[model samples]
Target: MVRTLLALKGALVRGALAQLLAAEDDIDVVGEADTPDELRSALRAERPDVAVVDGDLVTADQLGDLASDRPAGCPDGGPPGRLLVLVQQRRAARLGPVLAQHSRRIGFLSHDVAPGRIVEGVRQLADGRVVLDPDLVVAALAVADSPLTPREREVLDVAAEGHPVRDIAERLVLSAGTVRNHLSRIMAKTGARTRLEAVRIARESGWI
Candidate 1:
């Protein structure tokens, strides 16, 4: 049986990817959206067998926060239609929350992977199977035991943007001393000697 697919926007790369997938015998490209709002509309309207998305379409800073708030099931516990994601290496680390929430139906692929490999991932998702890039999985697993709390992550996220202690404190409504304390703990947890190093570690490990 032929499977229908809905693709979310990326750059020229995703257009090329659509062409590649459309050429597949078992897959039919059903819809494409250039924004998250449009994607939501297409998802409801098309209800394709598989939804292909580019990672940047989402603006959530931490999937862990979102996943924790919602049930660890499909929204409304509906049919387990698959979601295939194409993400950059750095952003791939953020997928741990999604993995925990939707284990077997979601797939992740590096944007730089070969078209043949990406088509294989799409086919796997369409067949009701899960697929994740090996290196991205390893990165997710490595950061699974993160020591920082959500508040700490927020503090570090501000710090990551080159903000000063006073500025981070003001943004989070905490005092400068409290912000410094959080940074100190973050450094200890990540084993970084300085705040900048800590931010680097957190980003690389997908903690932020």
Candidate 2:
């Protein structure tokens, strides 16, 4: 039996992902698509065993289509192709629920996941098992209590690195006062009394 994968990626990531999936003996990288509409149509036509989607499409509609789409040929009644998202560890919290609702068969991995791990994930997904980064799962479980926004998380992450407000401002290209504002909001959201306390809260809560 010939197995296939439809790789969905942005222009910057398209070539490399295709090259990686095409090299596998059990896997044939069937096609590629950049947009959700194109991807839906392509998957319906080819019915690949898996689709490796990019990490960046976070909207509900995008995730919904990625999870289940009723293209004319591949109606809504059957089991959909397994969905594996290549995402950064930090974005797991944001992407978790959407992935979960789509199917427990879903998994997330860092963009830096080894090529072998990527191949393994695709195969596991095809076999009806979940494949996820251990660290990403841990991070997701840890961040369950955090309601932190992404910008605040970015600020807290920088602060965790021991960068003072001024340095963080320079590195992030935000003004010192703007950085302080973000810190203040971070503290308020986390209920921390000071910067160190905020960093400690974030670290302990795994919001970073």
Question: Who wins the TM-score comparison?
Answer: 1
Q: Once model 1 is optimally superposed onto the true structure by TM-score, how far is the C-alpha of residue 43 displaced, in angstroms?
A: 0.8
Can you tell me which runs of candidate 1 are displaced by over 4 Å?
1-8, 59-80, 149-198, 204-208
Which of the numbered candidates is closest to the native, going by highest lDDT? Answer: 2
Clashing pairs in 1: none
- True-structure RMSD for candidate 2: 7.1
lDDT of 1 at 80: 36
Give a tens-digit lDDT track for model 2, residues 61-105: 356556765435544456667777787776555554555576565
Q: What does the lDDT come to for candidate 1?
A: 0.69
Displacement of residue 15 (Cα, Å) in model 2 is: 1.9
| Distance from true location, Cα of 57 in model 2, Å | 3.3
Error of 2 at 124 (Å): 1.1
Candidate 1, residues 6-98: lDDT per residue as tens digits? 455555765776788888888888878767567666665666677777765643332223222322244774463567777776655455667
Q: How many backbone clashes does candidate 1 have?
A: 0
TM-score, every prediction: 0.66, 0.64
What TM-score does prediction 2 earn? 0.64
Candidate 2 ranges beyond 4 A from true positions: 1-3, 6-12, 148-208
